[model samples]
Target: MQDKDLPDIVDLVREMGAFGDGGRNRSPGNSNSGYGQGGEPQAKPAPGLPAQSQAAPDLPGHLEGLAARARTYVEAASSPNTRRAYAADWTHFTSWCRRQGLAPLPADPQVVGLYVTALAAGAADNAPGRAAPRSGGRKPHAVSTIERRLSALAWNYSQRGLTLDRKDRHIATVMAGIRNRHASPPRQKEALLPDDLIAMLETLDRGALRGLRDRAMLLIGFAGALRRSEIVGLDCGRDQTEDGRGWIEVLDGGLLVTLRGKTGWREVEIGRGSSDATCPVMALQTWLSLARIAHGPLFRRVTGHGKKVGSDRLNDQEIARLVKRAALAAGVRGDLPEGRRADLFAGHSLRAGLASSAEVEERHVQKQLGHASAEMTRKYQRRRDRFRINLTKAAGL
Candidate 1:
């Protein structure tokens, strides 16, 4: 369908505040367990910090106003998801520092090294922080989590115009040692094959509105090879809502999904399937028509006893839960226990499923997935089914 064919549905916009500039101005030594007077947790100020106002006294009033507004844009530079994660990580780090009676700011190399070591040894987990101390005292973090924490620290420091010397021997040596000791092969999610997808779909009640939304989500997500965020971030049409990360357009023969992915903007073409039961386009159209989703988020909450649809978009976590629940109910891997099956399947399974199921060239798969390299796309081609050309058979033995 063309843009002019879109129905006139008013957008429901939600207000969101930008995350504090990584708590750049918060001091580490404020009492109340390192929190402000109002019981709100305070942040630590970076060392060598300059005056807060970017607007100088010498500037004109309007220019100064513009200068002040610049900080808001600066804070908005990072996405909310990213800022939230960084804030949590920062809070945890500061809390650890307070318990250790050490300084969190100035990005001290020796102290940072010790902090990372404690994380690897599980000692940091027990530190009094934003998160409650777990039942088990010392729970070591995974290599990936540790790395993310380090990146968070680096980003937080940069926000305050300070530099974290990650390359310093104290930090670098310990990281290398941690990798040598704790690194393991990456455990990938189990890819859902075409038959597996059909089985999972059978578990959902197609008669209900909730079922229609979910069925469309699963089918579209798999067919478009979309990420969980990409799936829920879609709008019925372009510019329908300010918050939508992407938009959809239905063509005569297929569906076109234009998204702002990690690799930037790209379009995914999902052609019509052989049957209505399995076709992603058909499923999406049915959901949209039944849900009355003329604009705004394509996938939304089904409220009022599964009879009514809400304007609020579904959380990305819902996608993961749905995939797991469906996979478990369908008994996708009958050989495995229920717990393992639940753990194995996730939102990424849909993307990986498409990568595994699509009988196409490597380059085509890579383009569809918007992967910068074929190696990245191949990583999603889980199981032995997608390994179509067997080199062993061609080589004379």
Candidate 2:
């Protein structure tokens, strides 16, 4: 027969409800609407369509939903820093969800538990070329890090109208298991001895512009318990170095410092000196005069014309390097068995040192350092505890 007169193979198959090669139609019912015929059932529907032939339900967009909910919770937080931290933590959690084939808006409790486990164990389940999950190498996350991540996850989920119930046994079990694990040791505090401070002071030429700036920087940092950012953000118009009678009024007394703080703005007071003096007037006067700073950043870079340039503020990392170089020049040891080099001591050391020195009655060091709790300040206090004990011994106590 001519090809045009021949019946189509597809039509013949549809009419017969079975292929010529003895293929049997396995469908359950003879619906007759593109399905079964005679007493036999039809073939299965195409893969993309719903198995039961029903319309798919629409769901909310994943990232859009997460962002809206995250914004509301973050805005109601106590401080800007907290907002930023929670946002970043949530972002990380969502990224983890994407990696695990889960939706970000409503993460499954089992998946959340797995992510926490991965973070604590320091490795993901899908590592390359491995028969099983492997360790995350030497830098495995600490128990505290894992705990914080879980907390962030829980907080995020709570914001999204979801509750991770204890009935979800995997999450509960993982959290319980982690609680039993020992926490990592606390971090060591940074301290500078009197001689070490003096040595660093002596290293500055004092005859030169940079030397004067360095001297002033160190003295102010020690006297005011100022954070690196606080010191760097100091404006002559806002931060008063001295009162009319020449007494230094550090941290605006009760006024909020608009400069650098964990919460963007912080209320701080000048800490008492080692001699229990309320004012650090002498240190303030000395720095202003030596640095020749009048109306700009108190600490600044020296210019080519031998002038102190106040255009740029010193960054925290620069402050750390400067401290380290000064330490080395002053004959201070940089190497420690377990601790990092002296250069690793950033602006935080100044605040920590002040907290350590201010071991007064009933006044917790955490208050001075602007820490959320005493436990945080204990880390710094422990570093300087030895010096405090030595000073007591020298006093014949």
Candidate 3:
């Protein structure tokens, strides 16, 4: 960084609101916990401290070191999943650009517009036999996804000290036109009703260890309103590591789930169910006791007729697959066409199930979901599966 860019760096850090200490003492560690773990930076570093000097010096060696640390903190500003998604988005954009002989890094706004047009037109590569069984083949990218891709492109350009000029006519007009032309009412995932959940649970093999694990996973996921990532990221012990997302405590009244989500840390209180067969807490206990999981990841891979449980934790995709497999086996959406059935149920169904079926105060439901806004809670809680939206309703249909 040039000496002149130091102030901009300071401003950027200030915007992220991360600086170690009040400048009274230099923190030994430079970790930035974007979650609640990273305590809010309430004030700027006090001037004249040696630590501040380390952060601000312009000498070649010092600048390089500071830049590296800054980069680390910048990357930490977002969740790992989001970073991965952005990286994948960038890769897709670059690959497309390569095919077209266009520069992707310092992307032209015109080219970006063209890319968005291609996406909306479903002009993706037709790789036969490469389609997932459920999705049939590559479909036109959703508007939300295309927009995110644009954002990723813009962010990457900015990181490289270049401007994407998303506001410029070349990009702005095309995106606006696309939105206007393609506007449609939003469609939501089908919420897993309580009965549907029970049916799904029955599909698992209760006699096997894997069945116990799946049963526990489904119950906890529904009760806690956990995201797929949160379900898998949990630890038996407190998730104290920097990467661990959340932890659960078995309490007398219910289980308390303290998780770090996009908004921040929020506590989800899940009470014991009336019946042992359906109780989330009981299922959790049954799974933990059977699996003999005392520490590390709560959910893990079981092998060799469930005799050995691997220490490694299950990934987010596993949760999605598990949900899909159970839902399919149970015929949760039997009325839907076979291929469409696969698209209907996913990890989010558990969360949506709790929101739609639970007879509780809205605030409690909202709190359990860790939603930053009441609107988001209502969106899931509305139960699109059962609720109908029709223009003729107003006409007394």
Best-performing candidate as measured by TM-score: 1
- C-alpha lDDT score of every prediction, in listed order: 0.77, 0.52, 0.72
Task: Report clashes for each candidate as comma-separated counts.
Answer: 3, 0, 0
Pairs of colliding residues, candidate 3: none
Worst 10 residues of 1 by lDDT: 6-15
TM-score of each: 0.82, 0.57, 0.75
The C-alpha local distance difference test score for the whole of candidate 2 amounts to 0.52
Highest-scoring model, lDDT: 1
CA displacement after TM-score superposition, residue 100 of candidate 1 (Å): 0.4
The residue-by-residue lDDT of candidate 1 on 1-397, one tens digit each, is 1111111011000001123233223232321133333223245332212222221123333444554455445544665677768767877787777787677766788988988988888888564443434664667888988899999888876655569999999999999999999998998999999999999999989999999999999999999999998999999888888678899999997999999888788999999999999999999999999888798999999989999999989999999999999999898999998878778999999999999888877788899899999889889998745446777878964
Off by over 4 Å in 2: 1-91, 125-138, 151-172, 205-210, 239-297, 300-312, 328-331, 334-339, 342-344, 358-367, 370-379, 383-397
Q: Give the better candidate number (1 or 3) by TM-score.
A: 1
Q: Give one digit per residue, the lDDT tens place, for model 3 in 48-138.
A: 1112213322224334567667756766677667766765676677566656656554447888887887776666443322322346556
The CA lDDT at 156 in model 2 is 51
Arrange candidates by TM-score, highest first: which order?
1, 3, 2
- Residue-wise C-alpha lDDT for candidate 2, range 135-172, written one tens digit per residue: 43535567777777777666655643357554477788
